[model samples]
Target: MLVAFSLAPSGAPTDSVHDAVAAAVRVVRESGLPNHTDSMFTTIEGDWDEVFAVVKAAADAVGAFGSRVSLVLKADIRPGYSGELTAKLDRLEAAMEQSDDPA
Candidate 1:
């Protein structure tokens, strides 16, 4: 399973969300799962239970800093598939390089 999620504190007392984002990202980084974090989202790949647990913890971390919390999640549940995170992109790049067709 691959999950890309964004968590942040809504109704925050201040404009800067770095603290809240850092807190949530801390949870993901410590989860021992293969993961990556970009500006908008953090993507994690792991078993269902482990991934959901990390998400829950991350949300909890964000909730601590604000009156309301927001979580946005997108998941690709490709059963029997693993390492699609990097593999998919690798395949696309390979195809692009090999193609002789003019763009």
Candidate 2:
């Protein structure tokens, strides 16, 4: 499973959310699961329980900073699929490279 999620503290005490975002990312990174974080979301690859545990912990971490937390998530759950995280992107890149169109 690949779980892509974004967690943040809404109405936080500070204007900059860097601290809270960092806290949430830290939880995901420290989980030692295969993961990637971009400007929009952090994608984690793991079993259902492991992935949910990290997401829960990350949300809880951010929730500490404000009265409300915002969590947005999208998941691709393939019971027997593994490594689709990298493989999916790799396939896309391969297809792109094979394209005849040029700008």
Candidate 3:
């Protein structure tokens, strides 16, 4: 399974939430799960319970930064697949390359 999530804090004193976001990303990274973080979301790959535990911990980390936290989560639950984090992108790039070739 792959979970992509974004966590942030509201009612924070500062306009920038980078620190809070960093806290969340730190939790994800420390989990030692297969993961990637881009500007918009952090994606993690693992079994359901383990992945969600990390997400919950990350949300708790962000909560310390403000009175309220907002979490957006999306999941792709494929029972038999792993390493889709980079594999999916590789497949997309391959398709793009194929399409670029002339008939």
Candidate 4:
């Protein structure tokens, strides 16, 4: 599961990205997911459904920080179970390739 997150302060980026990442980690941990990063976003792989819930929880926590949280969740949505939503650039690539095909 992936949660793309970005933080903006009132006047400037007062809080280092590290701090944001740490808080995000705590949030994810509270929701009970393993393995989080301190970069552009956080990604945790687990029972897809639970991961989705945790993503929301993490977002909520970030919002509580007073920083504008910008995130576009990417995950698969199956009939009842939501799966991991990575990048869909592959689909676009395929479409472009077909368009360029001689046939």
Candidate 5:
């Protein structure tokens, strides 16, 4: 999947934005989703489910700074018909669900 997200804090200082963005990206990537970030945006590619989950994690990381945060996310679930790519992500979700199941 391909995604573009933008974040701007409501009461955050400009100097802190870069660091905040970087930190958020780090958190998302740590979630097992690959992340690519530039000055003001982060692009993440991964399983459809994990993509959403990673964005949520990134938002949490941003919130950790105690600054009002905002985010925009875009994703493409139809990258290709080839099973090689999509299967990997599907497997990831299956693993996550298995790990999360309580019963």
Candidate 6:
């Protein structure tokens, strides 16, 4: 399973949430799970229980920054498939490359 999530804190002292976001991301990085972080979301690949645990821990870490935390999550649950993180992007790139070639 691949879970992509974003976490934010509300009622924070400052308008910038970077510090809170960094806290959440640190939890993800230390989990030893296959993960990727971009400008918007952090995606983790692992079994359901393990993955959600990390997500929960990350959200909890964000809670310290403000009165409340909000999380947005999306999941791709494919039982037999693994490594879709890079593989999906690889396939998309291959398709785009093929489209550019003249027959």
lDDT of 3 by residue, 1-103 (tens): 9999999899999979999999999999999999999999999999999999999999999999999999999999999999999999999999999999998
Q: What does candidate 5's lDDT look like per residue over 1-103, in tens digits?
A: 7566876555665545666677787876687655667766777776677777777777877776656778876655665533433466689999999999999
Model 5 — TM-score against the truth?
Answer: 0.62
**RMSD in angstroms, candidate 2?**
2.2
- Mind giving the per-residue lDDT tens digits that candidate 2 earns over 16-71? 77888899999999999999999999999999999999999999999888889989
- Local error of candidate 3 at residue 74 (angstroms): 0.8
Indicate the residue-level lDDT of 85 in model 6.
Answer: 90
Per-residue lDDT over 47-74 for candidate 1, one digit per residue giving the tens place of the 0 to 100 score: 7899999999999999989989889999
TM-score of every prediction relative to native: 0.91, 0.92, 0.97, 0.49, 0.62, 0.97
CA RMSD (A), model 1: 1.9
Which portions of model 3 show Cα errors greater than 4 Å?
none
Q: Candidate 4 has which clashing residue pairs, if any?
A: 74-85, 75-85
> Each candidate: what lDDT?
0.91, 0.93, 0.96, 0.57, 0.69, 0.97
Task: Give per-residue CA lDDT, model 6, range 1-103, as digits (tens).
Answer: 9999999999999989999999999999999999999999999999999999999999999999999999999999999888999999999999999999998
Instruction: List the candidate 2 regions with Cα displacement exceeding 4 Å.
Output: 101-103
Off by over 4 Å in 4: 1-17, 76-103
Instruction: State model 5's lDDT.
Output: 0.69
RMSD of each: 1.9, 2.2, 0.7, 5.8, 12.5, 0.7
**Poorly placed runs, candidate 6 (over 4 Å):** none
Predicted structure 2: clash tally: 0
